[model samples]
Structure formats: structure tokens, C-alpha cells
Target: MESSTRTGFAKRRRSLQGPFLSEDNIDVQSDVYIWNSLLSGYAKSSMFNEALDVFRRLLNCPICVADSYTYPNVIKACGALGIEFHGRMIHGVVVKSGYVCDVVVASSLVGMYAKFNLFGDSRILALSLQNDVVLCKSLINVYFACKDHCSARLVSENNIDVQSDVYIWNSLLSGYAKSSMFNEALEVFRRLLNCPFCVADSYTYPNVIKACGALGREFHGRVIHSVVVKSEHVCDVVVASSLVGMYAKFNLLGDSVQVFDEMPERDVACWNAVMSCFYQSGEAEKALELFDRRF
Candidate 1:
């Protein structure tokens, strides 16, 4: 079986060459794989319109049936092009073909709907999944994007047993922060701290700190400071810069300046954070001083 698979792969690779080798030349048995490869190549190249054109051709082909790989690339193309009408039509295809039960297809559908701000449909599709964590996470993010925090919270609560992956947690936190639900975001952060295995990475802190800054919750920001310090991730430039920005926003100039001073290495964003803080605080002289020093 492995040797046969290798031979098939080698044949596919060879078929990738030459201009006049039409799609018609592909064996009927290999049509799904060939169409998928072509669709994927077109989607990756950002030729979404061309990918849709090929998808339409595939749908019209009498012998071909849309498979799992076919829908994801085409749905992604629809999302990229903001072609919600086409996306709905693809959903119809999925339903009629009984591919709606496929997890990957369902996830792609949820993402496509979400990209167009169609949260109602996205949520319905998400709930239909028997055990789809990825789709649920996508729905959470879409709900957050639509500013429907209640819906996002509901999804998270219901999916608590779904073994929240890092991406899912990040999406929930980011959604709460983006929606200005700083307290809820902080509560989630606190819960994360209790999970011994749930160590925060660089991506986690920045969004949480941004939420603190937006709400001017200086105490929360300070707690995050202590967390960063203890995690030994303070040396990370991204985390340090985010802390500086958060403190600066909350008018904690002393803490902001201290974080900046302690940063062993600084990037353009780090300098910009302090400069923006100085500008916002009406200390034009200090801002200018820092800008001059950096330049």
C-alpha cells in the first residue's frame, strides 16, 4: 500500500509539469485528488476567482463528486473574495451531498459564514456539530467579531468539556478584550492561572494587557506585570513592550518607565510605545527627548 501510494504521488508530481496537460487527461479515479491539488494551488496563490471557476467546473462534471478537500479550498476562496452568495450556494451543495456532517467541511462553512459577519448561521452550524471543537472555536471568534459577547460566552460555556486548545482560549480572550469586556477577560485570565498546565505564552499576555489598558484597570495591569515577571517571560521583547504600553495607558508612568529601563533589548515598537505614552500624557518635551535619543 505504501509503495502504491508513493507511485501515485510521483505520478501526480510529474503531472504538475507542462502547460497543455488539461484536467481532462487526469484519470477519473484520480479526479478528486487532482482537482483538490489544483484548487489548493489556486487558493494559496490568492486566485480565488479562478479557484471558484474551477470549482464550478468540478460541480458540473458528470463523473466527479465534491470530496472533503474540495470544499475547504473553495470555501476559503469564497471567504477571501467576500462572496457570501457563492458561499451560501456551496452550503447548499454540502447539504444536498450530505457532506454537512463532515467536520472539515463544517469548519470551513463556519469560517466562511463568520468572515461575512453571518454569526446567526455560523452559530447554528456550530451547534449542529456532534463533537467539533475547531468549529466551536471558530464560532466563538465569529461571535466575538460580531460584538455578540453573550453568544461567545454561551459557546465557551457549553464547550467547556471540549478540551479547549490554545487557539480556542486565545480566541475567547481576544474576543472578550476586543468587545471591551475587560472584567470577563480578566476572570478568564485568573482561571488560566489556576490550570497548572495552562502556561501563558507571549501571545496570551499582549491581548490581556491591551484589555487592561483599554479599561484603565491599573490593578489588573500590575497583576499581569507580576505574572510576566514570575513567568520569566519578562525578557521577551514583545511582552515587555506590551507591559510598557499597558502601564503608560493607565497613567502609571513610573511602572512604564521601570519596565522600559529593565528591558535588556528594545525594538522600534518598544520605543514607539513609550513615545506614544509621553505624547498622550501631554509631556511633549519628554516625548521629543525619547524620539531624538532613539533616532
Candidate 2:
């Protein structure tokens, strides 16, 4: 049986190489796996039309019942093509197949619906995930993308315990920052600091610094600066860039310059940050000189 399966796969590969690998020649019972493999191949190659064609063909195949793997790949194809109707159809299949409760499938549905701006369906699907941290984060991100800060906060507050992982805290803080709830984001940042063994990543500090910049909360930014120094994460380009940007936003051009100078490594963004500070402070000539040197 294994040898026959190998032979079938080899034949399928050869058939695939031909110009006319049509549905007529494929033995439905023996070729179901091959068809699914081809569908995945098409999806991975970004051949959305071909992937959908294979998916549609699979729907009619007697041997190919829509399963967990099949639905996720087709949903991904729908997402890639921005085909909301197709996604909804796949959602229906998910429900019919009793796969809606599958965490992986449910998460894919949430991501697909979110990408297509189907927030209602996305929220419903997201809430159904039992213990999926990534799905919860994706749902928070979707709400954040939709500019529904209240809903995002509610999702985070309800689904995420105080003992949630750093990724969850970062996601919640990022959602707050994106919504311009700088004070709330700062509060969360403080709470994160209090968590035992909780250390901020490049993502955590940048968003928090951005919140400080947006709110003109330079004192808060300074305190964060102290933390960054103590944590030895100050060398991260993103953190340094955010610090420069935060100082610049508060009209502290001198402080911005000082931070820029102290950065161990500099990127184009860091150069831009300093140049922006100079320009915003009415030192256009210095800004131009810096830009010229950097470029």
C-alpha cells in the first residue's frame, strides 16, 4: 500500500508537469491527497485562481470532504484574494464540518475575517477560541485595526488574566497606544514592570515611548529612559529611535540630540529622527547638513 501510494504521488507529480493536468485524469479516491497537496502548493505560490480552482474541484470530489487542513488553506486563498464571499462560504463549511471549534481553524477564520474587515464575524469567531493566545492577540489587533479601542480593551481585559504572557501584555499595550490611550498604555507598562521575570522587548518600549511622545508626557518618557538604561536594552535601534522621537516630540531637541549621540548603533531611522528634531527646532541648516552626511 505504501509503495502504491508512492507510485500514485509520482504519477501525480508527472501529471502536474504536463500542460493539461485536468480533473478528468485524476482518480478521486486515490488522488485526494495529491489534490490537497496541489491546492496548498498553489496557495503557497500565490496562485489564488488556481488554488480556488483546485478547492472548487475538491468540493465536488467524492473522496475529498472538507477537513481542517483543506478549509484553512482555502480560507488563506480567500484572504489573499480579498474574497469575502468565498471566506464566508468556507466559514459555512467550517460550521458544517464541526471544525469551527478547532482552535487552528477558528484562528484562521478570525484572521481571514479581520483581513476582509468583517469585524462582526471576526469577533464572533475569535471569542469562540478556547485557549489560543495567538488568536486572542490577533483579535485584539483586529479591534485595534478597526479603531475600536473600547472593544479591544474589553477583549484584552476579559480574555487576558494579569498572569498572561508577555506577548499578551505587549499586544494590549500596543492596542492602547494605537488608540491614542497613552496614559492607559503607560499604566499597563508600569503593571508589566511589576510582573516577576517580565522583561520588555524592543516592541514593548517603542510603543510605550510612542505613547509618551503622543501625549507630550516627557517625564514619563524620562522614567522609561531610566528603565531602558538599567535593563541594558537601550542599545536596541527601535528603543533608541523611540527615545529620540519622544524627546523631539516634547520639543526637547537638545535631549533628542544627546540620545542620538549616545546610541551605540544607528540606522536610517535614527538619522531621520535627529534630522527631524533639528528641523522641528528651526535648525534647518543643521538638519540639511546631517541629511547630506547620512545620505
lDDT tens digits by residue: candidate 2, 190-277: 8789777466777789999999899887788899999998888899998999899899899898899899989888988889888998
Highest TM-score: give the candidate number: 2
Q: Can you give the TM-score per candidate against the true fold?
A: 0.68, 0.69
Q: What is the lDDT for 211 in model 1?
A: 82
- lDDT by residue for model 1 over 142-216, one digit each (tens)? 567556676666665545444345566677788887777888888777767775545677778888888888888
**In model 2, which regions exceed 4 Å deviation?**
1-23, 28-57, 67-69, 72-92, 95-104, 111-124, 148-151, 158-163, 176-184, 194-197, 288-295
**Cα displacement (Å) at residue 166, model 1:** 3.0
